[model samples]
Target: MTETTPLNDIIASRIARQGRITFADFMAACLYEPGLGYYTSPGRKVGAEGDFYTSITVHASYGRVVAREIAQMWRNMGSPAGFTLVECGAGNGRLACDIMDFLAEREPVMHQSLRLVLVEQEPSLESAQREMLAVHIDSLSWLSPDEFASGSFTFSGCLYSNELIDALPTHRVVMTSDGLKEVYVTCTNGEYAEEAGEPSTPELEAYLKRVAVELHPGQQAEVNLNAPKWLASAARALQRGFILTIDYGYTAHELYTPLRKLGTLLCYYRHQTEENPYLRLGLQDITSHVDFTTLMEYGEELGLQNAWFGEQYRFLMSAGIIEELEDLERSDVSDEEKLRLRLTLKKLIVPQGGMGDTFRVLIQSKRVTAPRLLCQRRIGG
Candidate 1:
């Protein structure tokens, strides 16, 4: 290809030697291959200047809403003397800062007991996380993905991730007339291309069966083996507490419906959706929709109760966004600034072609007795 970067060349050379590489491997390299990958590069990945905006980039209100839930979680755990809050995929720690700020201000007791462990793959981001979390440094620590997944880092508190699972490399497969075949990356005319072949593992088929989804002929889908592995590790590491996950996704049936022939994998660059992941190499961010059903099912298997799973808007509204809005009215800022904040916050929960409906929140708990949460509030409450 004309735009062959270092990572691209590395990936190309590997594929040339191996004949073909699973989309997962290609994607893993594209997004996380040391210095050359997308997330490993030195540039902004979120907010107005970056590729795309997650709910955290919208406003501090989102994390504040989450902090409200975390406070409830602390109460649910009977005001534990010690609690660990591990945030995976904690990019730059902005959300963590917001949560820490809210806890210090509104839930001093919990804040005092809180131990926030920021687990991120990119070691370089720790500086940014440290800078952003300067106020809560004593309550914070860092953990590499390998260290977190090592099965020795057990804790009793909440582990959360926002839009993390969707970034894990996934195996792409299609139901063909012959059978299920994986879509592997190959070189064609000096450019990356796809080639269908037999799946590398039986788990691909088992994953579909576990979800009870049978793709239509020629329909391609992604199987995130990493998701279950991640969940299993999280379940093991969490001796007792909750796993809160927020991402854009669907239930198994909804995600693997017959209509989606090309699967949900997508690339983002400069706020635009790019269908071609082959073009940008490490420049574009690659992601897919999470499957909440699998998370629920697997959580149950791992002894974690499916506490709550629903659209982000419902979770936000039921949790505490309205109260946040009410607090805005009492702030010293002018009404014009308040209005701007309101509009920006609306993006966090606005449905119908917005972040609200597409993104989902899932909260699963382990060894928590009959517990009540703020999101359990009735619609009118």
Candidate 2:
């Protein structure tokens, strides 16, 4: 018999009271149910101590490269006097600190006028973010997800997130003989199990339709209705500027292919991947591959132009990774440290068995005219 966790009991009680609930709701509870969730009651959720390593954890150069692009974005917007940089899922503020460090050192003018608004769902993490971003405390601010989407808070700058959409509670669906059905969580004899049922909303079907995706019979997939909804709120908040999203995912064609029958849903615990989300309850990280097609299509409808979209390697290379490397080479660090750093940085750009091709960067702009951003530059030229 499987040992039940505190969260497992909490969830089971809810199921007993509510009968059955959509998988999305179950996932939402497992991940964001106030204090007991994996992220909410966090204990070093990122880096070597945590379940996984983000691009931010790999090296500082990745953030430096991203900072270069933001600097260009400010320039593209005619160097606005008050440019707001909002990071939606700013975990520990490492990326924000790195980006801010680069901007302060290189683009002092822009840094001087910059206001960084960190929109995080977990309130406990604000303290860690505050400490991590201590140097830039004067330029920092905070916003709840509700406040950000409330339509009262608008900004004229770039908004970005890393691996955020995938973590948003997503509805699971499977193609059936009759049509499509959503996966629901039900409790029987105090044990949780999955069952197929009518979709919680019509938007699930409409989402696939918007992306022109057709699931093969017996194929399971995740529909992140929240992704588009979040993008819509982000679009409303951004009066003029860019939305930079970095995540591991594919276009609709690749994401919904017949070969990927099991879907991209997976869990992480202490660096090990678990196929069963039910195993760890709220102790593990639950995520799925984002569908970039929906973000692009929905972004277009929101009046944002798709400025650039491609592999992370391309974005890093074209947006000043090489310059960062050159600077590293000229630094006073020992040859041994330089060699180690060089190999570490390769993980960010290598395609096979690395973050390069699997992770993608999408830049969507609103009211920005023919912006020639740094990431759009040719690799060699």
Candidate 3:
């Protein structure tokens, strides 16, 4: 018996007009509607006090490690004079700031030729991104999601995102004796409910077929067709360079197993996980775990090489976490601060149940061959 929110009313009206909408459309309205959706609305969505915590919230060290890897990507491309780094879902620009700071200090040559394109769906976030990345304003630009994925915004250095894909609207489907049926949203006594019907797009079935996934009977799952479509757009946009995506997900095989029959759709509100997505409408953050296998497979088909994919800890360790720790130890900070820094960093690499293993990193490249990325190095290196 939750009260109807403005977003809820809007969605209900849409459903009333259209006679029920697909879950994906409902999610899009809930999370990205003009002024009241989860992301489009004005409220904190990340970090300790927000709905959920992303890797950027853990520490600056996380982004520094990613910067170290980006430097390697530049080196892999043979030190291009005009390199561009496009970061989609650039929230508050914290990660970009950390990367820019590290690049300006350590890889000055690369920084001199670098241009960063921040692509965010919410245009209002530009002000916050601008404020956070004020020091690197000379090298920054902004692009809307439509503009970034329009197959016109070309870049050359690298494109990256952290926890971006899971937030994209995804259609839900359930396996039945008859066949795969999509889960659509319908009004039941003025409350949102689910109904099984034919999929809105044939791509949902084809996505599973392409990934060689066959869900067990009665297995309910989410299909993020937008992911591959987005990747295709990313591929088309990147004339050359690499695509780095960091998020929490699994391969198609692991993701479609019978153990997880209910799929990975999750909601976050006030730092707690909520099972029902219908409660607060735009208030809670709804997300589905990404499917990395489709990314790797579809990337290959789109003329991108699957460079690397693994746990976050491995990426951080092999890339530059140890070096970051060493630098902190040699810094002017006090011993107590160093200890706190060490513990904070541990949160990024602590194995099992921690962020380290739960999250993952996937790197794909276009036109770069035999690239020697920092993530391929030994711990000390």
* Worst lDDT 10-window in candidate 3: 372-381
Q: Write the per-residue lDDT of candidate 3 for residues 1-381, one digit (tens) a residue.
A: 556899988888788888978899989998999999999999889988798999899999999999999999999898988799999899889999999999999999999989999999899999999999999999999999999887778888899999999999999999999999999998755688889998888999999999999999999998999999999999999989899999999999988898999999999999999988888999999999999999999999999998889999999999999999989999999999999999999999998989998999999999998778888887666
Question: TM-score of model 2 relative to the true fold?
Answer: 0.99
Q: Is candidate 1 or candidate 2 better by lDDT?
A: 2
lDDT of 2 by residue, 1-381 (tens): 235878888888888987799989989988888998888886888899999999999999999999999999999999999999999989899999999999999999999989999999999899999999999999999999999999999999999999899899999999999899999998777677899998889999999998888899999999999999999999999999999999999999999999999999999999999998887788899999999999999999999999999999999999998998999999999999999999999999999758999899999999999999999989956
Residue 157 shift from truth in candidate 3, angstroms: 0.7
* Candidate 2 off by > 4 Å: none
| Model 2 RMSD in angstroms | 0.8
lDDT (C-alpha, whole model) for all candidates: 0.92, 0.93, 0.92
Cα deviation of 215 in candidate 2 (Å)? Answer: 0.9
Tens-digit per-residue lDDT, 17-95, candidate 1: 8789999999999999999899998999998999999999999999999999999998999899889999999999999
Worst 10 residues of 2 by lDDT: 1-10
Best by lDDT: 2
